[model samples]
Target: MADLVIADVTVNKKASVYFDGKCISHGVTFPDGTKKSVGVILPASLTFNTGAPEIMEIVDGACKVRLKGTEEWVAYAAGSEFKVPGDSSFDIEVSETVHYVCHFG
Candidate 1:
């Protein structure tokens, strides 16, 4: 996919580190106060719990994900997206660096 350009957004300098630093993201806020993050995941497997419903858009590379309540892991590539319910968790396995934009709602 082409680069994601969200106009009039604020990008914070602080990095959101997770999985003992395996996953990292930065804070981004929209004009209306909605929150989001753009980050890159290293080659690793991680489980993430969401506080809000998240729409994860893959910006680069690929990964396999198994969402909550699901037994199968699906492959996602660049230009694809997945959703995770709030207060739930999911598993992601990445073989390469994967860039993503996460929209919180």
Candidate 2:
């Protein structure tokens, strides 16, 4: 797990809401130019497309994710993480309200 406290980052006040408000996130930028999004996904099934590779760190709650071109749905809970390739997509079913940090690269 990464640090719980993220310091020296600029957080965008405006949120990026998706899936008709089922998912909401705020972009954050580090001092070194790294970018991430801190967000919450309400209980729902959603598909997300990635323009960049992403490592999604689960902060709280649980979800099952199936990556693009895959059939198996992997379960992830608090303290767990999953990676999605760039230019691909993933289907996520959130059983609980999921709090996560999406690291982009």
Candidate 3:
């Protein structure tokens, strides 16, 4: 499980909105220079490309994800997580409003 509270991190004031506002996120930087994004995806099917390896932590709601080169769609709910390889893409089908924290490396 991810931490409920992250202290002393820098938060970007502006949000990154995508898919015509169906997805929105705010970037955060930790003291150690680690980067992450806290975001929400509304009920929609969307494809996302990743620049860096990422672990998508589900904070609330549920989603089904199909990674690049994979045909299976795996279901994930709150308290679950899925990893995406760098430079890869994934298709996501959101059944509910998904609140997530994306850890990047």
Candidate 4:
């Protein structure tokens, strides 16, 4: 079994954290004191925490990012930077390996 841990993204540093079945790209703090990061979904992964959203830059393959209230999900290519708000909920569908730099604050 994996241990449970908590983190504060308000400081400054890169943290590659490993959870139960997923690896998360954590450590982000905004000017308004908000924290966020990207959770790397392992094969056969599903999450219930529709985590606080922010902005994501696709650093790799195809990524399907859907907004909380939008009818259509957007496809982001490499180097694509977009905002989806922290309070807004969403999901991800990755056909291939997708990498994102999660910025929250």
Best by lDDT: 3
After best superposition, candidate 2 residue 1: deviation in angstroms?
5.8
Off by over 4 Å in 4: 1-23, 26-53
Model 1 per-residue lDDT tens digits across residues 1-105: 466676788999999998888889998898989888999999899899999999999999889999989999999999999999999999999987899999888
| Clash list (residue pairs), candidate 2 | none
| Worst window of 10 by summed lDDT in candidate 2 | 1-10
* Number of clashing pairs per prediction, in order: 0, 0, 0, 1
Candidate 1: clashing pairs of residues: none
Q: What is the C-alpha RMSD of each candidate to the true structure, in Å?
A: 1.2, 1.0, 1.0, 8.6
In angstroms, give how far residue 9 of model 4 lies from its true place.
12
Ordered by lDDT, highest first, the candidates read 3, 2, 1, 4
- lDDT (10s digit) by residue, model 2, range 1-105: 557867899999999999899999999999989999999999999999999999999999999999999999999999999999999999999999999999998
lDDT of 1 at 41: 92
Judge candidate 2 at residue 8 and give its lDDT: 92
What's the lDDT for all of these models? 0.91, 0.95, 0.96, 0.58
